[model samples]
Target: MSLKFHRDKLSPLNIWPGFVDALTALVMVLVFVVLVFVIAQYILGTELNGRNKAVDELNQEMNRLSALLMRAKQDINQLDAEKTQLSEQVVTFEETIESLQSQNMTLSTKIESLTSDKANAAKAKMSLEEKMAYLQSQIQELMSQLKLKAIAIDQHKSNNQVLEEEVASLTKKLKSALNSEAIKLANYKSEFFGRLKEALADQTDIIVVGDRFMFQSEVLFDSASAELEDNGKEQLKILAQTLKKISKSIPADLNWILRVDGHTDKRPIHTKQFNSNWELSAARAISVVNFLAQQGIPTKRLAAAGFGEFQPLDTTDQDGDYNRNRRIELRIDQR
Candidate 1:
């Protein structure tokens, strides 16, 4: 048993060696595997760290690039704004240029018009200068003529003084003769008038005024008529007879004249025969002068005249005033 036990221990010892070898091999293999796992973990960690660093760098790069892009956009926006302002400035410059061009054109036209007007004014000035020279020469000629005329006027003044003296002497003699004749004629006129008053004593229409005899128109003619009535003819005949008697005593060179003046009232008259009171008054005076001529009075010694309403003895607006204004007047005067 002991032997068997010893043998058994020896056999187990052999097996233990084998088991020890196997354990040793397994330990070596496990150690190798652990080493390989540790190496792989280190490598993986390194790789992961490298990858994280790269990612961080890439993120920083992306952030930088985004900032650059934002700046670029801002620059683009600023450039666009500047471009817009430049465009507006360009438009304003263009409008200002157009306005300056229009002003320049207007100034050019005004310059041309002023140039033309200046030329015309120069021509007119030249013409005026020539006319002034001509007028100066004419003034000199007129001055010479005035000197000659002054000399002739002096000579005429001398002659006129002599003639005035002679005329004064003759006028004084003539005035004395005329006064003598006038006195004689006045005496004859008084006698004639006295005789006429006696001959026409029954007639009330005749009146003697200052150096005149007045007869109402009603006593001579009908209303608005120029013809002589029968009573007017008779009265005129008596006047003619008185005048003939007075003429025989008057001097032949007395130069006496009988003036028959016809007057009219303010009333207007319109007829086929007489257009106005002036014409009617003129016709009545002519009729009176013609009747006196037929009564043997010389035509040269008789005168006729017509006075319209312009000459009024009475200016009152009354019937009696109008009647007094309408009359015939007889006056004796020098021819």
Candidate 2:
């Protein structure tokens, strides 16, 4: 039996030892592969850590950029607000300029109107001055004429007194011839008036009223003055020459007189020279008598009288009537 078992083990089907050796070799190879895989894993972990650090740095840079953008937007908004306020101020300035222009135009028109009115007033004043000058000239002309009439009368009165004495002596011698002489004297008086009228025919201011020669006061005298002017002296000289011729032809016994009567308007006078209209009229008549005496007229043949504000040719209360009421008259009458 022992010999049969030993022979079975030694047979070719006894592969147990060889199988254990192969299994041991396969286990060693698996160990080597596990070591290689552990080394590769360690290298991959190190590379991943470096990539994570780079990503964190990139995220911080992006946040900083976003903060800068927000600041830029805020600045833009502030600028827009300021621009709107400036535009409103510019509009206000334009309105003020327009109002000032309107006011300037209104002032210009007012100045032009005032200038026109001033020119018109100046023209009116010039015209008034011209009219006043004309009126003054007229008054001066009237004044010169009045003075001559007054002077002529006084000269005649002095010559008449000498003639009166001669006539009285002649009358006593011609008593029987008185009636015929009276008739002759009456005829002579008419002839003398006709001759006097002829001598003064060219004078329109002297008017024959009844038996008297009437003259406007203004034609013979200045206002409130008895002084004779050059023109008045010339006129009185002519009258004195004519009267001397008439007196030589007349008979001295007739006792003829040339009555010089002065009249004044109702208007009263109170001046340094004259106290009233009565004094003015009386002075004018006396002035005439004095002038006639100076001209070699007979004093006895001249008579002076004054009527103050009593008799007037014109009755109405008018400026022209007042002028007409003032008069002077020459009349031939018995002394």
Candidate 3:
């Protein structure tokens, strides 16, 4: 009974040792598994971090590519707009070119018409010039004929001018000769007047006037009588002597004479010997001329004239005026 109990106990102890070894082996296996798991987790975490970094880099690259695409799209759109503008400008230029071509054709046709007109005008000008040349030739021939006729007229005028000059010269010479005689007569007359003025200086009633000597009617006659007074005869004797002296100095060619002009007042006179004032005036002048002739003065050198109040020294109807008008005027003059 004791041996069996001991054997059972030993068998139980042997079971406990095997069980402990199995537990330890199980613990070591669990530790090795935990270590492997930790290593695996570390490696996995490192690999996951590297992959996440790569993914973030790839995301940034994609964002950059998208921005580039947007810019390219904008450039294409702007290019399209510029192309549209260029097309419009091309259309305008083509239209302008066509208009210019039409104007050029019109100018070409006008230039051709002008050229034809210019040729026709040149032909007409040539014909007109020929007609003008013919007219000029005719005018020249007429001018030559006129010049010949003018020369002939000039020759005739020259001959007539010679005869006219000769006649003019002869007339001039004759006039000069006559003028010389006249000058001599005038000088002698002046000298005769000077002598008479000195001789009759005391006689206030006798006055010299413009180549003539005036004698009052009262000095020569009484009242309306033609008979000369004694004093008048003395005056006539002095005039006769003066005339003779002057005549001796005068040239024979000078036909000088002493004229006695008698004047009467406007009073009417009718008498036995005188019918009117004219007759009385004429008788007075004749009496003076006859008395001078009797005093040895040449009859041809004496003249008598009467004026019945026609030529008056004074025109007023007064006593003094009548006295002045009723006078005898003695003039020495050319016949």
Candidate 4:
């Protein structure tokens, strides 16, 4: 069958050809569009697969960033804790500074008290020094008075020593004057005896011995009698005148005495006028003193003594010695 014949039976014969040509053209256009869509879909799928691989790599980077953010948060928390501790230390330092300022005020008050005590002590020391100066002046005055007393005592001792020396000088002068007077008296006695010896030189019955003139008792008196004979009285007158002449030449200050001593022989005698030789001898001495007084001789210058047989001139018991023992002696001496 022909195409035109199949078309006539289905459609009107006049429009069938145009419609068939249009439908065929439409189917060719649909087939070309479908082919272009399939090629576009394959190219899009290949690009999608590359984009998926890049997305997986981005997810792994985001996970790493999240872990780093968690660690940064922990560090911020530790920094906050340290800032709190530093704030507490600053408050404690402020309290310590306030306590030190209070102690400085207390020490300042103690130093002011010490300064006041030092001023009071200086005033007391000055007052004590003034009192010591007054006491030293009083001690100096007492020492001056003691020195004046010592000088007065020394002067008194010097005067007493001078008076003692003057008294000793006067006593020595008196002793020297007495010794000169005694020597002059002795010279006068020696001159008087020498004159008596020259006057009686030719008379054998009269002899001079030492400082005395000795005469035999028989020449002056009778044996065993007290009376002076005539010749004895004449001889005594001559002796009295001689002594008177010599005494006038002597110094009046020299008071001299003529001593008459009568001695007897060793013989016992008993007579009516005498009991023994001692009485006879005494009477003979007294007779001679009385005769001299009558011859113008001073009685004050005459003295008499008597000696019996005890005054013998010769110790042998013989007649010649007995005659010599019986004698009268005159001596001149100081009264």
Q: lDDT score, residue 286, model 4?
A: 93
> What digit string (tens of lDDT, one per residue) describes model 4 on residues 174-279?
4454465567766777777777667777789998888788889999999999899998887787789788888876655556889999899988999999998888
Segments in model 1 whose C-alpha atoms lie over 4 Å from true places: 1-167
Query: Worst lDDT window (10 residues) for model 3?
Result: 85-94
In model 1, what lDDT does residue 128 have?
49
Candidate 4: lDDT of 56?
A: 52
Q: Give the TM-score of candidate 4.
A: 0.49
Report the lDDT tens digits of candidate 3 across residue range 1-335: 99999898887334888899999999999999999999987987787577556545655654554455455455545545554554555455455445545554554555567886766555554554555565456556545655554555455456545545554555565566568767888899999999998888999899899899999989999988999999999988898888888887675556898999999989888889998888888899999999999999889998999987788888888998998899999988888
* lDDT agreement with native, every candidate: 0.78, 0.68, 0.77, 0.72
Query: C-alpha displacement of 27 in model 4, angstroms?
Result: 99
224: Cα error in model 1, Å: 0.9
| RMSD vs true structure, all candidates | 71.7, 75.4, 77.1, 93.0
Give the TM-score (vs. native) of candidate 2.
0.45
lDDT for model 4: 0.72
TM-score ranking of the models: 3, 1, 4, 2
Q: For model 2, give the 10-residue run with minimal summed lDDT.
A: 149-158
Task: Tell me the lDDT of model 3 at 320.
Answer: 89
Higher-ranked by lDDT: 1 or 4: 1
